[model samples]
Target: MHGDRGLTVGGPPNAQSPPSAADVRAQLDILLASPAFDVPARARRFLSYVVEETLAGRGDRIKAYAVGMEVFGRDKNFDAQNDPAVRIEAGRIRRALTHYYLAAGLSDPIIIDIPKGAYVPHFAWRTEPVTDGPAATGPPPETPAASLPPMPRKRIMWLGAGLAALATVVLLVMVFLIPSRDAPVPTAQAPMPGGPTLVVMPFADLGGSPETKIYAQGLTEEVLSQLARFKELSVLGRETSRSIPPDADAARIRRDLGVRYVLEGSVRTAEHQLRVTGRLLDAETGAVLWSQAYDEDLRVRGFFAIQDDVAQKVATAIGQPYGIIARSDERRTQAGAPEDLEAYACTLRFYGYRAALGPASHAAIRTCLERAVDRYPSYATAWAMLSMLYLDEDRFGFNPRLGSPTATQRSIEAARLANRLDPENVRGLQALMGALFFTEQPVEALRVGERAVALNPNDTELLADFGARVGQAGDHRRGMALMEQALVRNPGHSGYYNGVLAQLAYLERDYERAQLLMRQVSLEKFPLYHFVSAIIYAQLGMKSEAAEARDRFLQARPAIFEQWDREMAKRNFRPEDATLLAEGARKAGFPVADTTAAETALRTAAPQR
Candidate 1:
């Protein structure tokens, strides 16, 4: 006989009779005691439930949803299609059965097999050896029980029997003492230390066309990358999650990746329109966290817009503040046309290139922003991006011809145009603040940066930049507070955030904390990181460390010392403040020059109220 899932039953002709009910029960107990069944408690429970149900002739009633509710403790209303716990467990159980048969149970007298695609188990007797082909048919001779060797003398025979009995008992005890060959090996779960880890699964292509498949794949990668930018969330890389089976259950994903949340979605492209639908689930419990559907015209801009919208929705679903939501809502209200879409698309490309940080990328960003502004001259966002591009080039030495003065003038003009186009443009104000700072208008820059923060406190980059600028302007305490708040909102913020905190610490004379904070900054990426660190170590009386830090700073940027002096002069620091920093650097073993006269003149020429 065979089970519905193609599992064979019964034994060979020479094999023993089929196992009784009690025998089968004993076998199950022994198997459960083996290492093969040492799975998660829930998986073991599921396996036992299905096997017992089949033994009771209830295999027909063992449906996916039934197993989910009764065996896995899921709600009675669990949807079998959406939550694939039963199917996933069935696969795991099948693998466990194979493991048992191949290793510990290889020579067992009976076999238990759970065939694919079914909950029923098939029981069969082990085959016996055969000596001849089908042509041979003969009865074998039996040994005579009455034939035996002559008995020994009574006393000697009794002594031999006693020793034999003792030896048999010892062998039985040894057999019982040895560990079972089929015990399950323990597996360690991967550590997930920070915020809950989430994996955005590759989106399914509902349209079925190759084009639609490529589009869906691209959308999935884009969404994954966008989610990674949020420091509040720990997102798994696309390479780790792209190949997840479409029907994989939450428990399987949790077991494999140790993730708490799974985001799955589908994309469909039709005639001139696209629709995206997504759902978030609690991977351990198979509970739906959130789901949404979006529809838009089928265009590149529309696709990007939907991708951004989905990422924002997922972040909000997981308890993040919906800052992007507010920004997008404001953009929609301000610019209600297709032209704004094109400009926003261009700005998105510009940011992508800017992050690349290559010379070609800088040129590409400039081109993108210039075209964006030309296409929509009144678009405040595009103008702001262009202004920021100029400032970045000047600050990072991306272009040799664009000197500080020329870059500062261009940036200020673009920022003014952006603000004039839209007074409520927060990004424009942010760019204008940077321009003002570079142009030696410290008071106005502080005012503008504060206004930008007031408009959007959730902008992590703005908060960090503003905090640094404000601290440099001699208000260390308030600037440190803002930066700390930003860290709370974004614990995984960039290294620059750490550098700002270190700078504030140095300003407050907290040498130890400043030293510790500076260690978090990348010296290669921010050469000034070493400068502040050197000053902190010198102040802490660590002469060797201070000298080493100063050497590293100079090695990274030999001209940084001169650049620093010029920038400090532009900021017009107070005489006492300049003296303290200069003295600290000198004590740290830096070759310092006299800037006391310049500092004195700036202090004496105070502007009238």
Candidate 2:
């Protein structure tokens, strides 16, 4: 049965009762607090607002744009028509509700659901079990219950024990089909929750030769192993996924295995050249997400060389930050909706904040990370990002606890926690390095930073950031190399990369190159950006442009300019680099510092090893 406007649904003819407003609200509270939800803050708010609005009979306000504004913190400028963020969020909320009921809310009295294609949420009472239904299995209506002969007591007990044993084995294969290297794969699915999942089906050998088949198998295994390294992705191991036939299409794999993403490819090996074609698919819809072909001349490259290069390129393309998977998630989760931040989504916010270094985004991401670590205390990436945010608080003036050592201490504590959780996490090591720099332990900081980059040279963001820090620490040439490599990997990288690269150019006496790179930095009220701009313009003898740039820097960073020595120490700049920057600023008509910031920076410089 249904209530007014289909807002209330009855479970069965004899449902106890449709839940009242209080019942729904109570359920909502439980759901929001449940560990099973594991939702970011924005998602929780979306659920609460829609349910509350529907319950209050104000369902008209549940439009996507309205919810986007009131609940998701979107402003009027939000383009609801173009951005499908709200629609994507609705689907995620529905999936979360299903996950919740399947686990934590199995016996709950009321049910809350956002039906397909609508924002109006419906409430229903749990249905009663049917007592008068047909028999579950066995004899038909022709046979009476009393007419059946009874089994012997000993045999019955034995049969019961056998059934229990069979049930246990079935449960393990069907529900916990975890893959291992030496073990056989079960022809069933597992239900390990959290994040998106992937299945790399065995690649086809188009050449159909024994050698080609062996090559394909090895390539497929390598790809699977590479994908497994991305901590956020839940990947089915090779032994388990190998049982899946190379031709097992995405739709069938999804239905049989419950994986969200599928990687399918083929290998064509010839004496002249080897060609590998790969395609990523949305398992649910069988929609292709990404596809590419790699062609390598066999005469020029060995099989192992080609395999390693293709594997590295493909993994980096699909799983790296702002890569295919990241972009796909961006659609499902509005990047602007900052609220815990799943450690997956938590580290992502750093890129957005790093882009502009605005106060609002900083505060929102900070709050999100705090809530995230509270919920998932063992999450290393969340702690790592929180540490960076703390560093930004002093670097960009986002901290309210100014002049206090609390933020710095918190930054160091969080970074250390991240390292304790995952010593190999490059981002965590980066955070630790930043914290070390904050404490004037530049020697340890540089060591940590060098180790971090060495640990994961493939991580583009780390390369860019470490480049900037090293440049500041008097290694402009080495820093320039790292930043350039990062820019190649991430073409759509943040403006900060260009900003740092520009400073390095200035240090190298390439004022023309510095000015060219400087023009690329957006005017977002970033004090350091304009400060460098002023120096570059003055060097080029553009007097009026230099004056304007100096004014912008002064207006945005009056405090930093006044306490120049402290800022220098905070930045961890090497003495030589600090001196060069100060000289440029002096030539740009900026006020001279009360004392030489270079001497202050000298105290923190790492000695030659």
Candidate 3:
């Protein structure tokens, strides 16, 4: 759903000779100059660059990362895995090419197209346009009527109607063939374009026994239920494909259900052993993206336990963020800023901001999400993303709009609205958990976090976020366990995971361990990272590094010095631990706490004790 979801997978090249260099250049020029290609300068430049590079035999170098930096003005830091700008433009360019071919370039000699799921441009000679003339470069001329035998008026009318009907059929076929992720979904029965889609076909009962059929059916249902827990995937239930045979073609599934991926499997039982084979297919090409065969000694584990374990493994491999489809989808490009604000698409924009947390992207995400919720007030995901953005205003000091609602209040309100709208949505619960944590409700926050994780344990980002929150709130063991599970599921996860892990180590007074973990943290603009590193360095007697880290932290979040205890409270440190951290901060060149403030703190603590 991110980009080019509908384009057909390119098959083998046709037997026709490849277009000559001159013809390829002519076609490129003609398409760019066509009235149908009303693309932005950046998209236009992207098209020209890729086409020229392909012609110059540099197609291998054309990738999302390269296109992003060279053509779209993104810096070297532009991560294609998170930023979808290049991919979105690729889809736009594909649509423009379709429009041009449908109207303006019907008779062009050479066809130049950037195939689906790639940045490389392909060139071929068009089979549709040939003339009585040899290799003409322009539109083929209309044959003179006098050169052909004249037919009766009635026969001519019939021929004209047949040609018109054929053209109508071709138009309809082309419309469905074009990738249209931003288009409004037809209905709930159809897969939403907000994410990649999959259909869990009924698993085949290869053994042809009653018990095996039952197991196959049950496993299929289990896989469906597990995948449905992931918010980013649109899974078609097995009931949608009950009529189709187990061996039905993947293209048939793609055509009927319009899904991008297909999961099909078979189970066999023999000699007290159970074997299951499963495959994940790219629906567009019927190519197997992933496949595995699992064997279990039926005597060792109970049948239901085995079923549950297999189902969970399948969901984790395919449905989780950064999982199979996500990684495959990420390889090219899969994001767009649609003209109309779909609530689901808005969630994707929020992720783009979450990846870097830069203020520039934050403002854009906030604006887009605000408009999305404004248009679709009932959208739970939009409310959830909005809640997180609001919390970041206080957490990361991102909000700059004056006279706005307080970030804490708005975050709480939005999180509540999201949960109210969709009680089971993990993201809604996550937003609520985050808002509660920031408001000094650590117990309630942990309670909600546990439920959120249980509701969708495959959500790696949620796992990492909850781990960071709970670890800071003092449940060190569970926090570390969850973070480790997340890392195992998604090793390419953002640097924030290690950054959080480094903080957990710092809190444990494992100065060397913290320093080691901190070395692996590659995050930018996270002030808390500097704060934790300063204290860890101070504890290790690295005074110069400690002072430098302290200065950077102060440069980013200077107000942390003014409300030291309050800042300590935000991290949910134990009272004694807070004092220890303060002492470390002093050693790292922080000013001594004011005498009046210290006296006020003591008097307040005297009663609480």
TM-scores for candidates 1 onward, in order: 0.43, 0.65, 0.62
lDDT of each: 0.64, 0.72, 0.72
Write model 1 residue lDDT over 228-263, tens digit each, in one string: 644434577676685578888888887766666888
User: Which portions of model 3 miss their true places by more than 4 Å?
Assistant: 1-194, 205-215, 268-277, 285-300, 326-343, 525-527, 591-609
TM-score of 2: 0.65
Candidate 3, residues 1-609, lDDT tens digits: the string is 222122223322224335545556656665664434545556779999999888788999999999988897788889998998888788767855764665556655456788989999887655531222344377645877635543422233235445545754554454344222221111111112245778888888889345898889889988899999987677765557576676678987775555679998899988688888889999989889989888998789988999998988888888876578766665434454344325455566566577667777888878877776655454567778888888888777785544445787778877877776568988889999999999889999989999999998878878898998888877766777788888777776646777777777776777798898887776364556887788888889998999989888787778767777666677676665566667677878876484324345555798887
lDDT of 3 at 437: 93
Give the C-alpha lDDT of model 1. Answer: 0.64
Clash count, one per candidate: 3, 0, 1
The positional error of residue 253 in candidate 3, measured at the CA in angstroms, is 1.0
Off by over 4 Å in 2: 1-193, 208-210, 335-346, 402-405, 525-527, 594-609
Q: Which order, best to worst by lDDT?
A: 2, 3, 1
Q: Deviation in angstroms for 80 in model 3?
A: 37
